[model samples]
Target: MISAVAYGWKVTSNAHKNHETEGFKQRAEDVDQKAVNIHVANIICSSIQPLQNRAVLNCIEEKVGPDEKFPWAKFRIEKGFGALEKLLKDHAGRYATGDEVSMADAFLAPQIDAGIKRFNVDMVKFPNFNLENFLCI
Candidate 1:
Protein backbone atom coordinates (compact mmCIF):
# COMPACT_ATOMS: atom_id res chain seq x y z
CA MET A 1 0.00 0.00 0.00
CA ILE A 2 2.76 2.43 0.88
CA SER A 3 4.69 1.53 -2.26
CA ALA A 4 1.60 2.05 -4.37
CA VAL A 5 1.02 5.43 -2.79
CA ALA A 6 4.63 6.41 -3.42
CA TYR A 7 4.41 5.28 -7.02
CA GLY A 8 1.25 7.24 -7.50
CA TRP A 9 2.88 10.32 -5.97
CA LYS A 10 5.86 9.92 -8.30
CA VAL A 11 3.58 9.77 -11.32
CA THR A 12 1.66 12.79 -10.15
CA SER A 13 4.89 14.62 -9.45
CA ASN A 14 6.10 13.97 -13.00
CA ALA A 15 2.80 15.24 -14.41
CA HIS A 16 2.98 18.35 -12.29
CA LYS A 17 6.57 18.95 -13.42
CA ASN A 18 5.45 18.78 -17.02
CA HIS A 19 2.67 21.24 -16.32
CA GLU A 20 5.01 23.70 -14.62
CA THR A 21 7.58 23.32 -17.41
CA GLU A 22 4.90 24.23 -19.94
CA GLY A 23 3.81 27.13 -17.76
CA PHE A 24 7.33 28.46 -17.34
CA LYS A 25 8.12 28.08 -21.05
CA GLN A 26 5.44 30.66 -21.87
CA ARG A 27 6.19 32.84 -18.87
CA ALA A 28 8.02 36.14 -19.12
CA GLU A 29 11.68 36.30 -18.11
CA ASP A 30 11.66 38.64 -15.12
CA VAL A 31 13.73 37.74 -12.06
CA ASP A 32 11.87 40.18 -9.84
CA GLN A 33 8.56 38.71 -10.92
CA LYS A 34 9.82 35.20 -10.20
CA ALA A 35 10.94 36.27 -6.75
CA VAL A 36 7.58 37.82 -6.02
CA ASN A 37 5.78 34.72 -7.22
CA ILE A 38 7.84 32.44 -4.97
CA HIS A 39 7.37 34.79 -2.03
CA VAL A 40 3.60 34.82 -2.43
CA ALA A 41 3.49 31.05 -2.85
CA ASN A 42 5.52 30.59 0.33
CA ILE A 43 3.29 32.90 2.32
CA ILE A 44 0.12 31.11 1.27
CA CYS A 45 1.32 27.52 1.33
CA SER A 46 3.61 27.68 4.34
CA SER A 47 2.21 30.30 6.67
CA ILE A 48 -1.50 30.75 6.08
CA GLN A 49 -3.07 27.59 4.65
CA PRO A 50 -1.46 25.18 7.11
CA LEU A 51 -3.01 26.88 10.13
CA GLN A 52 -6.48 26.71 8.66
CA ASN A 53 -6.40 23.12 7.46
CA ARG A 54 -8.78 20.59 9.08
CA ALA A 55 -6.11 18.91 11.20
CA VAL A 56 -4.91 22.15 12.73
CA LEU A 57 -8.40 23.48 13.20
CA ASN A 58 -9.42 20.25 14.83
CA CYS A 59 -6.35 20.31 17.03
CA ILE A 60 -7.16 23.86 18.12
CA GLU A 61 -10.73 22.94 18.82
CA GLU A 62 -9.76 19.76 20.62
CA LYS A 63 -7.05 21.42 22.71
CA VAL A 64 -8.70 24.77 23.38
CA GLY A 65 -12.35 24.93 22.36
CA PRO A 66 -14.47 24.57 19.26
CA ASP A 67 -15.20 28.29 19.24
CA GLU A 68 -11.47 29.15 19.05
CA LYS A 69 -10.94 27.86 15.51
CA PHE A 70 -12.71 30.65 13.65
CA PRO A 71 -10.88 33.47 15.43
CA TRP A 72 -7.55 31.69 15.06
CA ALA A 73 -8.11 31.16 11.34
CA LYS A 74 -9.41 34.68 10.85
CA PHE A 75 -6.36 36.22 12.49
CA ARG A 76 -3.90 34.17 10.48
CA ILE A 77 -5.76 34.82 7.24
CA GLU A 78 -5.92 38.53 7.88
CA LYS A 79 -2.22 38.74 8.70
CA GLY A 80 -1.24 36.76 5.62
CA PHE A 81 -3.65 38.71 3.41
CA GLY A 82 -2.29 41.99 4.70
CA ALA A 83 1.27 40.86 3.93
CA LEU A 84 0.22 39.74 0.44
CA GLU A 85 -1.57 43.02 -0.20
CA LYS A 86 1.50 45.04 0.77
CA LEU A 87 3.84 42.79 -1.19
CA LEU A 88 1.75 43.01 -4.35
CA LYS A 89 1.21 46.76 -4.03
CA ASP A 90 4.03 47.85 -6.28
CA HIS A 91 4.21 44.81 -8.60
CA ALA A 92 0.57 43.92 -9.24
CA GLY A 93 -1.20 44.92 -12.39
CA ARG A 94 -4.37 43.19 -13.57
CA TYR A 95 -2.94 40.06 -12.00
CA ALA A 96 -0.54 39.45 -9.13
CA THR A 97 2.60 40.07 -11.22
CA GLY A 98 1.28 41.60 -14.39
CA ASP A 99 -1.55 41.76 -16.94
CA GLU A 100 -0.92 38.23 -18.07
CA VAL A 101 -1.24 35.42 -15.55
CA SER A 102 2.11 34.33 -14.13
CA MET A 103 3.46 32.08 -11.38
CA ALA A 104 2.18 34.35 -8.63
CA ASP A 105 -1.32 34.30 -10.15
CA ALA A 106 -1.24 30.51 -10.30
CA PHE A 107 -0.62 30.32 -6.55
CA LEU A 108 -2.77 33.32 -5.61
CA ALA A 109 -5.91 32.23 -7.47
CA PRO A 110 -6.84 29.18 -5.38
CA GLN A 111 -5.75 30.72 -2.09
CA ILE A 112 -7.94 33.72 -2.80
CA ASP A 113 -10.79 31.43 -3.72
CA ALA A 114 -10.41 29.51 -0.47
CA GLY A 115 -10.11 32.71 1.52
CA ILE A 116 -13.39 33.91 0.08
CA LYS A 117 -15.30 30.65 -0.13
CA ARG A 118 -14.04 28.51 2.74
CA PHE A 119 -12.85 31.03 5.31
CA ASN A 120 -15.24 33.86 4.49
CA VAL A 121 -12.38 36.34 4.32
CA ASP A 122 -13.32 39.96 3.73
CA MET A 123 -12.09 40.98 0.29
CA VAL A 124 -12.35 44.66 1.00
CA LYS A 125 -9.39 44.36 3.32
CA PHE A 126 -7.16 43.07 0.53
CA PRO A 127 -7.92 45.50 -2.28
CA ASN A 128 -4.61 45.27 -4.13
CA PHE A 129 -4.84 41.51 -4.62
CA ASN A 130 -6.69 42.24 -7.88
CA LEU A 131 -9.70 40.09 -7.02
CA GLU A 132 -11.70 41.27 -10.05
CA ASN A 133 -9.29 39.62 -12.46
CA PHE A 134 -9.03 36.37 -10.49
CA LEU A 135 -12.78 36.17 -9.86
CA CYS A 136 -13.53 36.56 -13.56
CA ILE A 137 -11.04 33.84 -14.39
Candidate 2:
Protein backbone atom coordinates (compact mmCIF):
# COMPACT_ATOMS: atom_id res chain seq x y z
CA MET A 1 0.00 0.00 0.00
CA ILE A 2 1.16 3.55 -0.70
CA SER A 3 1.55 5.83 2.29
CA ALA A 4 -0.05 9.22 2.04
CA VAL A 5 2.17 12.26 2.25
CA ALA A 6 0.82 15.77 2.60
CA TYR A 7 -1.85 16.97 0.14
CA GLY A 8 -0.98 18.06 -3.45
CA TRP A 9 1.68 16.90 -5.84
CA LYS A 10 5.18 18.10 -4.95
CA VAL A 11 6.99 16.64 -7.92
CA THR A 12 8.96 19.11 -10.04
CA SER A 13 8.81 18.87 -13.82
CA ASN A 14 9.50 21.09 -16.83
CA ALA A 15 5.80 21.25 -17.53
CA HIS A 16 5.67 24.74 -19.00
CA LYS A 17 7.89 23.80 -21.92
CA ASN A 18 5.17 21.51 -23.21
CA HIS A 19 3.32 24.67 -24.23
CA GLU A 20 6.03 24.84 -26.94
CA THR A 21 7.18 28.36 -26.21
CA GLU A 22 9.33 30.11 -23.64
CA GLY A 23 7.55 32.54 -21.33
CA PHE A 24 6.35 35.76 -22.93
CA LYS A 25 8.70 38.61 -22.17
CA GLN A 26 9.84 41.91 -23.70
CA ARG A 27 11.70 45.05 -22.73
CA ALA A 28 9.60 48.04 -21.74
CA GLU A 29 9.12 50.95 -24.17
CA ASP A 30 5.70 52.57 -23.94
CA VAL A 31 2.82 52.40 -21.46
CA ASP A 32 0.39 49.95 -22.99
CA GLN A 33 -2.82 49.73 -20.93
CA LYS A 34 -3.06 45.97 -21.33
CA ALA A 35 0.54 45.44 -20.31
CA VAL A 36 0.03 47.85 -17.44
CA ASN A 37 -2.66 45.64 -15.91
CA ILE A 38 -0.42 42.61 -16.09
CA HIS A 39 2.39 44.61 -14.48
CA VAL A 40 0.07 45.94 -11.78
CA ALA A 41 -1.48 42.59 -10.91
CA ASN A 42 1.94 41.00 -10.50
CA ILE A 43 2.99 43.80 -8.21
CA ILE A 44 -0.22 43.51 -6.22
CA CYS A 45 0.15 39.77 -5.89
CA SER A 46 3.81 39.99 -4.83
CA SER A 47 3.09 42.58 -2.16
CA ILE A 48 0.81 40.25 -0.21
CA GLN A 49 2.64 37.04 -0.98
CA PRO A 50 4.43 37.48 2.32
CA LEU A 51 1.31 36.73 4.40
CA GLN A 52 0.66 33.25 3.03
CA ASN A 53 4.37 32.57 2.92
CA ARG A 54 4.55 33.71 6.51
CA ALA A 55 1.64 31.44 7.27
CA VAL A 56 3.68 28.65 5.78
CA LEU A 57 6.59 29.92 7.78
CA ASN A 58 4.33 30.11 10.81
CA CYS A 59 3.63 26.47 10.26
CA ILE A 60 7.34 26.03 10.77
CA GLU A 61 7.40 28.58 13.61
CA GLU A 62 4.33 27.05 15.26
CA LYS A 63 3.44 30.50 16.50
CA VAL A 64 -0.24 30.84 15.64
CA GLY A 65 -2.81 28.19 16.57
CA PRO A 66 -4.29 25.86 13.95
CA ASP A 67 -7.37 28.01 13.43
CA GLU A 68 -5.23 30.93 12.37
CA LYS A 69 -2.72 28.84 10.46
CA PHE A 70 -5.09 27.00 8.12
CA PRO A 71 -6.59 30.20 6.88
CA TRP A 72 -3.70 32.37 7.84
CA ALA A 73 -3.93 35.46 5.66
CA LYS A 74 -6.27 33.36 3.60
CA PHE A 75 -6.78 36.35 1.35
CA ARG A 76 -3.23 35.94 0.10
CA ILE A 77 -4.01 32.44 -1.01
CA GLU A 78 -7.10 33.83 -2.68
CA LYS A 79 -5.03 36.50 -4.39
CA GLY A 80 -2.66 33.87 -5.71
CA PHE A 81 -5.65 31.98 -6.99
CA GLY A 82 -6.90 35.11 -8.68
CA ALA A 83 -3.62 35.88 -10.42
CA LEU A 84 -2.90 32.33 -11.55
CA GLU A 85 -6.56 32.13 -12.47
CA LYS A 86 -6.23 35.12 -14.78
CA LEU A 87 -3.21 33.59 -16.46
CA LEU A 88 -5.11 30.42 -17.25
CA LYS A 89 -8.06 32.47 -18.41
CA ASP A 90 -6.21 34.71 -20.90
CA HIS A 91 -6.15 31.70 -23.19
CA ALA A 92 -9.10 31.10 -25.55
CA GLY A 93 -9.80 27.57 -24.13
CA ARG A 94 -8.52 25.66 -27.17
CA TYR A 95 -6.93 23.00 -24.99
CA ALA A 96 -8.83 19.77 -24.23
CA THR A 97 -6.41 16.83 -24.63
CA GLY A 98 -3.12 15.11 -23.68
CA ASP A 99 -1.56 13.69 -20.48
CA GLU A 100 -0.75 16.88 -18.61
CA VAL A 101 -3.15 18.89 -20.75
CA SER A 102 -2.50 22.63 -21.08
CA MET A 103 0.51 23.35 -18.93
CA ALA A 104 -0.50 26.72 -17.55
CA ASP A 105 -3.94 25.35 -16.76
CA ALA A 106 -2.45 22.30 -15.11
CA PHE A 107 -0.11 24.51 -13.12
CA LEU A 108 -2.79 26.96 -11.98
CA ALA A 109 -5.43 24.37 -11.06
CA PRO A 110 -3.88 22.85 -7.94
CA GLN A 111 -2.98 26.29 -6.71
CA ILE A 112 -6.58 27.38 -7.18
CA ASP A 113 -7.85 24.25 -5.46
CA ALA A 114 -5.53 24.86 -2.55
CA GLY A 115 -6.79 28.43 -2.32
CA ILE A 116 -10.40 27.23 -2.23
CA LYS A 117 -9.66 24.69 0.49
CA ARG A 118 -7.45 27.02 2.48
CA PHE A 119 -9.61 30.14 2.30
CA ASN A 120 -13.16 28.85 1.94
CA VAL A 121 -13.71 31.33 -0.89
CA ASP A 122 -17.12 32.13 -2.36
CA MET A 123 -16.15 32.12 -6.04
CA VAL A 124 -19.72 32.69 -7.24
CA LYS A 125 -19.50 36.48 -7.34
CA PHE A 126 -16.70 36.32 -9.89
CA PRO A 127 -18.81 35.05 -12.80
CA ASN A 128 -15.67 34.64 -14.88
CA PHE A 129 -14.27 32.37 -12.23
CA ASN A 130 -16.31 29.39 -13.43
CA LEU A 131 -15.62 25.68 -13.45
CA GLU A 132 -15.44 25.84 -17.24
CA ASN A 133 -12.62 28.35 -16.92
CA PHE A 134 -11.14 26.08 -14.29
CA LEU A 135 -11.45 23.00 -16.51
CA CYS A 136 -10.12 24.71 -19.60
CA ILE A 137 -6.94 26.78 -19.83
What RMSD, rounded to one decimal, does every model reach? 5.2, 8.7
What global local distance difference test value does model 2 have? Answer: 0.41
Best candidate per TM-score, number? 1
The local lDDT score (0 to 100) that residue 75 gets in candidate 1 is 81
Estimate, for each residue in 11-129, the C-alpha lDDT of model 2 and write its tens digit: 11232223233442121222442343344334333533344454465773487676666555665566655654454345323331112233333334444454566556666533434
Clashes of each: 0, 0
Which whole-number lDDT from 0 to 100 does residue 104 have in model 2?
Answer: 32
- Model 1 C-alpha RMSD vs. true structure (Å) is 5.2
lDDT of 1 by residue, 1-137 (tens): 44322343344345445644433322345778767877877787766767657888898789879887877787888899899999999988888777776666666676778778878899898878888888864
lDDT at residue 119 of model 1 (Cα atoms): 81
lDDT of each: 0.72, 0.41
- What is the TM-score (0 to 1) of candidate 1? 0.78
